[model samples]
Target chain A: MQPGEQRDEVEMLSLMLLIRRFEERASQQYQAQKIGGFCHLYIGQEAVVTGALAAVRDDDYVITAYRDHAYALARGTSADACMAELFGKETGCSRGLGGSMHFFDRKNHMYGGHAIVGAHVPLAVGMAFAIKYRGEDRVTLCFFGDGAINQGSFHEALNLAALYKLPIVFICENNLFAMGTSVKRSTSLKQIVDRAEGYDIPGEIVDGMNFREVRDKVAEIVDSIRKEAHPAFLEVRTYRYRGHSMSDPASYRTKQELEKYRLDDPITRLRAQLTREGKLTNEQFDMLDKRAKETVLAAVKFAEKSPEMPVEQVYDYVYFNGAKE
Target chain B: MREITYRQALNEALAEELERDPNVFLMGEEVAEYHGAYKVSQGLLERFGPRRIIDTPISENGFAGLGIGAAMVGLRPIIEFMTFSLSLVAFDQVVNNAPNMFLMSGGQFNVPITFRGPNGPAHQLAATHSHATENFYASVPGLKVCAPATPSDAKGLLKTAVRDDNPVLVLEAELLYSSKGMVEPPDEELLIPLGKADVKREGTDVSIICYAQTVPLALKVAAQLEEENISAEIVDLRSIKPLDEQTVFDSVAKTHRVVIVEQDHPFCGVGAEICYRIQKNIFDALDAQILRVSQEDVPMPYNERLEKAVLPNADKLVTAVKQVCYA
Candidate 1:
């Protein structure tokens, strides 16, 4: 398919599969202590990031929570920097200042993988506010988990964004749980989108596990947001296959329940659909799978070879000042 | 040059900045409609309209985080907390996000935002509403903290802060808002250098070091002591983060006596840093022990008498100066 072609279903499928395989490999590495400190994997929720990211332009800003490897990869952070960041090496996106929870690429307009639950939401609002205030037509895509919706900053940002009519697309990936607690246990309102009505902004629920659904919904809303210069909210209902971090013993949810949700694995479902529609051959699928494996391996190798930041470099990037220390 | 209240100078600076730069705007509770609770934003809504001068909900953390986020995208936002006391609700945004964003983003973003408004004890507003946040904010590396004492410094420092490339905390004195001083009208292009001290008064007997409201009190005390044949030099530390200790120490070295006055409680106050640096650098130069006159170590009281007693007022400052000079 031509790169300019209106996002081919096969390409969407390939992107989802790539994110899945990359995360699977990272999960293993994290378990082995190769990827240290607060690793939140996006295993079951690949479709939301993959689909939503595909719908937006490169100029649009994308920021999300700590469960952000998939979102970062989808937004064009190189596999090399992504894996290196997970390794806490100097070559990482944040120069090893932010390990897994704070991935950032300013040039690419990917703001952060902010660790604080609802902190980045306001940042997204501010970025969109800047775009509108400057008379520029740009959108800021802010993604957060279900738990973030309950935070005071989230409501405050949403209210300000709504009041100013800032161009922003707020994507809430409601993956059932925040760390260990379920959304139902945490929030009185089961559907997080219901909270948006309090701000007088439009809100909708998307089957986050479905690539086409997320892509179509996001594309429709993003296009309108660009035209209207206002904010929109989308709650992508999804799930996570692994524990909150790397050290969990799979105690949050039952294996049977996990297996039930795994039936709709975004990557497998997309791959099967692409083959059925003749958009991709089994051989092409195999080649893509092989390419993904090689890419992950190369990233691991690059990170392994990368030098650790010197003791002096520990405080180097603490401030942007020109001093080495 | 015009003589205006410190509040008016800040208002003028904000209005001029908004007109000069399209990227500059103001956000805070009662900033737009109520013409600013303290009237610092008076007539701004009528002048710049609703788009630039925004009134926010009583949500400091939200608006503060919004200001940080907006700054990251190249918009210079001036976020006002009605008082420094309310800013504790937004402390995480100030310390965590505002400072960490630039470094965490690998220089891809700059938080060119100013979180300003009156800081320090204000009348009998009680414990929750009275606070000195210079030390709290200065402890963070990615931030630039300024506590301007005079109307001129407030206007100049605010203008510089708005145009700075980093997140700046402008600690305005609530009491100084009504104080009149000579201020040059807004020079949008002019930038006052940060991290410098202003020698408000020159003397040879002892050095009275302070900033914000305490500087004025120190200066008044210096004047009263002048009749007693004692001279006191006054150093108003304009910025706290990149502390201007040289100017302070130079005075101390010349005078051989030092007295530090601050509006905050003595424990871990902004004066503590000045004392530490003074002891470390000019221990032998001091003829008398460095004396610090600060607020009493108690939650700011609501009663006027208690509030006055708790704060470092002219009386406390004068007493400290006399002790330092006679010791």
Candidate 2:
């Protein structure tokens, strides 16, 4: 491996570990009743977000559906704020107004973690439209699950993005199952990328399990979109280790299937690849794991120490000029 | 001031806002190449270029969400639904996404978008086409719903809607598009504020409150009542959501009776809210129980005479006013 490639792989492994640890802690918090509402962990889908986000510009906007804790962290949102948001605290990214489902950081150009499935797809296209209208070269990376492809919004968004040639990268994290229903049971076409062909936009499927593969494919696609000022679709094939949400028992899939994917864990595979290249030793891997755990624990402390949003301020932030207040 | 059609006034508003702010652009099906479905955006494409005056596909959900996204990123997008009935396809984007984004994002993002189009009962455009959606949109907290009646108000309020920091829904009347009224010159820049009501015709015996397509009916009823020496007042509710409740209550206090005229059906409609607010705030001031003249509860029919029968008109408002006056 080239020196830069080796360094990139190491950084990717570190972020994947951080995301995995963060989500594991989130799952625990949800079970402990510290986190309320629907908690959809991104434990198994870390490589997709981490790899895709690594290829985009810092100013480029990012929007995704409910399962977005990992995406938020990958897009530069601090773990503390994300944790505080999950805790519904005043110091949260959404000021406690949005919990788990909606996470927004304007400074980092992370538009939001929209709760509604496939709803924010058009918004991503619009952001791309604005970028092109303003003559800016920035592209928007919109993430959705395999399930969102079935929504009319996904088709409409793709049509407009292709029609106007908006600079957008639509990344579908096809984790095999959407919520509880497997893609095979719900979608007529098993391949999500095939839907993009109808819109006449370039689309391809990448192995979402491999961090290097996802990162390289996304970088190439995003680079082309930036140059051509058009939208592209990517279907990242990956798996989720956890259930759809904290409340789900995941009875649909068998233990063997879960174990199969566990072996193909993105973090484990990346760590092994780095180790084989001598870029990371066993001590280094242990240190990275220890560091991620420390970061997650610190985030938990921050969230616990964070005060609850005052009851009186519940109606705040409803409008820009304080119309409601 | 010069007499111009309501369509021209709306077109002027779009052209003026586009000229004032480089970030402002118009997007909708037929808004550009076709010069708008109702010619409300006529000549805008030629002036602003294709980039600024975008012509989208028949994808309401797609474009509406796209406009919201653009608004979040700092561009002011004017999303024209051919009619609000068509906006239903993109209702999730309008109702859930646009309005809730600012609050949900902790005020990190403000969607400064305007969704404007010909709305309410018009001619024989039956069932699916004729939808008076003021009540539906106005019920939402974050959205600012405007139903302008006159050409001047159409021009002024639309300009304000484009400039407002929040998502504003400009519900125009299809029937009132060609209705002529005096509007200020483009350089004068007339801008009517939202959430304020205009007493079109002031009187004492009774008040005829209405908006959008029903405003003309109320005005005609007021004129007809003047002949009978009843002295009726006409309150045009330009802004529906942040309703001018004070004006409504003041009119009720003076007249002691009110008859709400709305194009929408009576149940939980704009008239229903007006009636409830009047009773809640100025109950003692009312000398007679308030009455409401609204469209019959049925799907709009394709037959012209039947369509007219289903809608509330000047004669209906006049009769409603007389019943309230006990004449």
Models, CA RMSD each:
2.2, 2.1
lDDT of 2 at B280: 93
Docking quality band of candidate 2, CAPRI definitions:
medium
Give per-model TM-scores. Answer: 0.96, 0.97
* Proportion of the native interface contacts kept in model 2: 0.86
DockQ of each: 0.57, 0.67
Report the first chain's TM-score for all candidates.
Answer: 0.95, 0.95
How far residue B46's Cα lies from its native spot in candidate 2, in Å, is: 1.0
Writing each residue's lDDT as its tens digit, candidate 2 over A65-181 gives 998888778877889999999998988898878889999888888888998889999999999998998888888999999989999999999999998888999999999998999
List the lowest-lDDT window of 10 residues for candidate 1 chain A: A316-325
